[model samples]
Target: MSYDLLFTGGRVLDPGSGRDAVLDVAVSGGRIAAVAAGLPREAAREVVDVAGRLVTPGLVDLHTHVHPGATYWGIEPDPVAWCSGVTTWVDAGSAGAYALPALRRAIGGYQVRVPVLLNISAVGLTGRTGESRDLAHCDTDLAVATVAAHRDLVVGIKARIDAETVGPHGLEPLRRALAVARACELPLMVHIGAAPPTVGELLPLLRAGDVVTHCASGIALGRGGLDPALRRAYDAGVLFDLGHGSGGFAFDVLEAQLAAGMPPHTVSTDLHGRSLHGPVFDLPTTMAKLLAAGLTLAQVVAAATVAPARALALAAGTGTLAEGVPADLAVFAVEPGPFPVADVHGRRRTAPLRLRNEATYLAGRLLPPRLPAPPPPWIPLTAAQRTALAARDRRIRDLLTTPLVTPDDLADQFPRPPDR
Candidate 1:
């Protein structure tokens, strides 16, 4: 069959098939058709020679916030993720029952595949501290219905039950979220740290398919490192995610966790606009941090690609470079130097290595360069639309300015608002 593109002379590393060798890969119809030494380029349409770069399966970022208006925490998803060699990004609870439609609309027509985790809160993380604060917003029935409605895009359920975020109703909201997750037959991604319940209490509540994010965090009420309870959870097949967000990770905690043989199941940069420049720069930087923490090259790559896809239950070959798999690949350079990597705290550690993305390909197409463009002309709002928008804006403003009311009081005030 005629091919679309050929990538030649690169060191191919595919953990799925346990193959590592210098090979030429051929892409036909946007899928990998062959990987062998000295494959003839004569049958190909275009050839990209990457002699010295490391060619691996396209990276998968398991944790991110991609929803545009639903969550203002991060940069736009496609450019930030794809330019950095990430092809598939699992949006970590940026939308919930109410905002899923808008999130889908924002991302549906894009090339980059984004699987979203439905937040337990109906509104998702549209707030400064996140969306799990008001226990009344954690609607199990609505969350379950939303997941069922968008079964193709919604992969799992997410709940941030941190102390500062969840306030007093810590475990109660989590219990309700789990109930929703169970009803939908999907895994639950729990953001643990600085919470009311002890790690001991939290671990028992999770099952095999559940996920524990911020596993090495020092910010949680249980600032204690990865304890025996967490290990028990891991042993029981509960996945651990390295959600290295702006304020959740701690190098000390990570070191202790790694030392205790509790390696993270997936390595993800909880990247956002504020955290993009440092501490959690990007997916490659997060992987480099894991390497600096003593994981081997293969181990780090596996966590970033295969393991994350497995956790999300993406198609079998989606994150690997095996023949017949989609031709999504990343070319990277591993530079040797004393690279200073920091944790959530101001502490830093210098390691003798760093991985940087040299090039990225989605399917068989190279990503187009980002260009600056003029802003669009403002359109005049219709009288009816303007009035409705004004009313909605006022309601949101009032909700923000209102004093901290009980969940029951909030429920009474906003009784079963329609899903957005």
Candidate 2:
């Protein structure tokens, strides 16, 4: 049988099936047709040699904000997603009921896979403190209705259940989000940082199939250094995701968790306007950091691929390179290096190995890499750009503080489809 494309001579490492060997992969239409050594070259219309490179299933980032032009925290996904070889990106609660219709409209145009986690709040993250800050916004019924309305786009519910996002409401927002998730019959992904309810308070409320993101953010969960609370949650089947945002990942906290025999169930980049710049450039960078922190390449690949695919409850063929699956895959050249890796706190570590994305195939087709965006404009400026604009410029302040976008901003972008 003739194949649409062929990838030959690559180290195919698919942790999902314990596939780690040099193999040739053939694609027919958009699904993988075969995976073995030495397929006849004449059988494929196009063949690419990938000797010495690592071939992985298309990556899935469980946390990101790609509602660009619609939310203040948003960014264009194609440029970043293509550059990083990520085929799927989950926008973690960037838009709620009022804004979801527009967010969905924006996502439909992108070629990438964007499964969203509906925000439990009515207004979502487009507010000063966040949607959960005011309990009035945590309309469980509204969120339930919204999820029901957009069941195709929304896979789960997201709630930033920290002191900063939800304020003194503590665990109240989490509980409400849980209710909405239950009502919608979807999983709940909770973002935990410094918390008033504490990690202890959050875990027991979460049942199996729920997720706790930012597991290594040096929050109350990591203060005591990887204890029973985390272990119990893991035992309860609560997935831990690395929501490595601008401030969510801390090496010390992660090391402690690792020492206690715990690692992230899935890896994700909380990519947005702020994090896409530095410290959290992309998912590979996040995965490389963990590789530097002692996770084997296989472990890192599993977290980024198969594990996240399962966590999101994606369709049957979502995260594997097995035959009959979508031919979504990535190629990376693992470079030996003393690469400088930094966490959110500006602390740095030198990694002995780094994974560099060389090329990617999206559903049996290769795409040209778009030029990467320059480092955040403010990063390279002089003292004047720093001090002169420090007090007056809204853009500078927004970049530095990384505040949540206001509801008015989203309303302007996705204006509620004129009443009937």
Candidate 3:
């Protein structure tokens, strides 16, 4: 069959393909139709010869905040994540039952695909500290209904059991989230850095398919330094996700865990508005940090792509370059220099290898550069524009002042509509 596009001559590094040699990949109708040695250029209508670059399955960031306008921390349009070689992004608990429709609308028509983890809290991360502080917001029934409604987009459930967030009600919210996850047969993605219960107490609650993000972080409930609780959790088949956010990664703790044979099951950047600027710039930077933390290049790539997709139970070949898989790919270059990688704490490590994005493709289509927003005109604002701006400001203020869902309102919101 004739192909739509062909990529040739890059060092193919798909672990699933089991062929790291130079090969040509042909795409037909957005799927990878062929993978073979030296496919003729005449076989395709469009061809791009990528030589001397590392070509792998597109990077998948499993933890991020892309809920625009709903929360102060959400990142809009995800800042060209695909341009940084990320093709799939999973917004981790940014929008819960009440806010998901708006989040989906904001991301409509984007090239990159965004899956989400439904938060147990009905309001999701709508407030500055998240809704965890208010136990009333942890609505298991509402979370289940929301996930059931958006099964295609909601891959799992997220619960942040941090100390400052959950306080004394940590386990209650977590238990409610787990119930929803069990009912839906979906995995639970728990954020464990600080907490009311110890990591030991938390590990037992997690089952085989459950995931624990911020695995090696040195914060309160984290493993600290190769704690036995983490090893036990790993042995129990609980997946550990390297959610390297601004305050969730600890270099020393990561080193100790790796040394103690607790390797991460997946690598992801918990990219949000505050963390995206530096330290944890993007997925590529997170991979670089893992490389510096002693993971092999192959291991790092697998954690970012195949492993995450598997954890989320996406298509088997979704994160691989299997013959019939989609044509999503990322081309990168490993720069050799004194690359400085930092941790959540004010610690830094200078490593020699760093992954840098060269180009990104989604279903064989190169992503376009982001257009800059036009500057405001110097002339006095028109009356209509002023009125519109004022209306918008008022709407934002109203949204902020609106009372959030309480745990007591869970039953009303789920399996039944709220009272008018």
Candidate 4:
């Protein structure tokens, strides 16, 4: 049977299906038709020769903010996704009950698959922080109902259990989030940061399958050996996620956790407005950071793909290149170098390899290149960053204005009608 597209000459490394070799993946009708050593190129309508790149299932980032107009954290996902190789972008609580409809409207415009974690607070991230300060905003009943109605889009529940987010209301917000998650039969993803309700206080409350994002936060969990509280929670089957945001990831904290034999279950970039410009640029960079911290390429790939998909119990074959799965895939050149990677605390480490996305595909279609929008006004940037952005804009303008081909270089298809 003829195939829609054939991707050849790439090292296929889909950790989910234990596929790691040079394989040709064929796509037909937006699903994976075959993955084998040799797929006859003549049988395919289109062929993409990814000679020296790594081919894997599209990276599934479990934490992001894509609701552009509805929240301070939101960023447009398509532009970033096209270049970053992230196909399944899970917006980590950019919307609560009130703003979910707006988030849904925005999702309709994105080219990537967008799953969301509904915020426990009714007023979800409208402001920078303090969303759950007013205990009344943590409306469990409304949140549960919202999840039930939008189960197709929402995969889990999110709660920011921090001193700034919850104010005088200690762990009440998390408890309410748990209530909603329990009611909706969804996984609960809790963001950890500087705490009034300490890690020790909240770790016990989490059930198996609950996720602790920013698990390496220096501000919340500290920089020493793994705390017994964390150990207990981990042993009890609580998933630890590397939610590497602007203030969440610390190199030392991650290293210590790795030393303690507790590797992250899922690696995600909490890619929101503030963290988008620096620190947490995309999922690939975050994966590189994990590499610097101690995980292998396969380990991080599994964390970014299969592990996160499994954590949220995503669709049957959401993160694999197996036959019959959707043809959402990423191609990357794994450049080897002593790349200096840094954490939120300005600590640094040398990454042995970095992934540069060469092409991204979704549903057997190549994702077009999309330029990122300028940072929002409220997003603070250094003077150097501002100048760099200005230069980039000028470069794009220059490229667009310049002529592609001169009269002699162009083909005269109509033959000018004999100078009529």
TM-scores for the candidates:
0.85, 0.87, 0.86, 0.98
User: Can you write out model 2's per-residue Cα lDDT over 1-420, one digit (the tens) per residue?
Assistant: 999898999999998777999999999999999999999899999998999998999898999988765565677788776667798899999898889999998898877888999888878766434667789988888888888889999999998877778877888888899999888788999988776768888888998989999888875566555757889998889999989987789888888888888888998999877787666989999998898788988999999999988998987667789889888899889899889898888777777788788887788877565544333443334464346445445655567687568766665656678787
Estimate the overall C-alpha local distance difference test score of candidate 4.
Answer: 0.91
Off by over 4 Å in 3: 221-224, 371-420
Quick one: ranking by lDDT, best first?
Answer: 4, 2, 3, 1
Q: lDDT by residue for model 1 over 300-373, one digit each (tens)?
A: 88998899888878866867988888888988876887888888787787766777787788887776644211
Global lDDT of each candidate: 0.79, 0.84, 0.80, 0.91
Ranking of predictions according to TM-score: 4, 2, 3, 1
Clash count, predicted structure 1: 5
lDDT of model number 2: 0.84
Best-matching candidate per lDDT: 4
- When 3 and 4 are scored with lDDT, the better candidate is 4
Q: Which ten residues in a row have the lowest lDDT in candidate 3?
A: 371-380
The C-alpha stretches of model 2 lying farther than 4 A from their native spots are: 220-223, 371-420
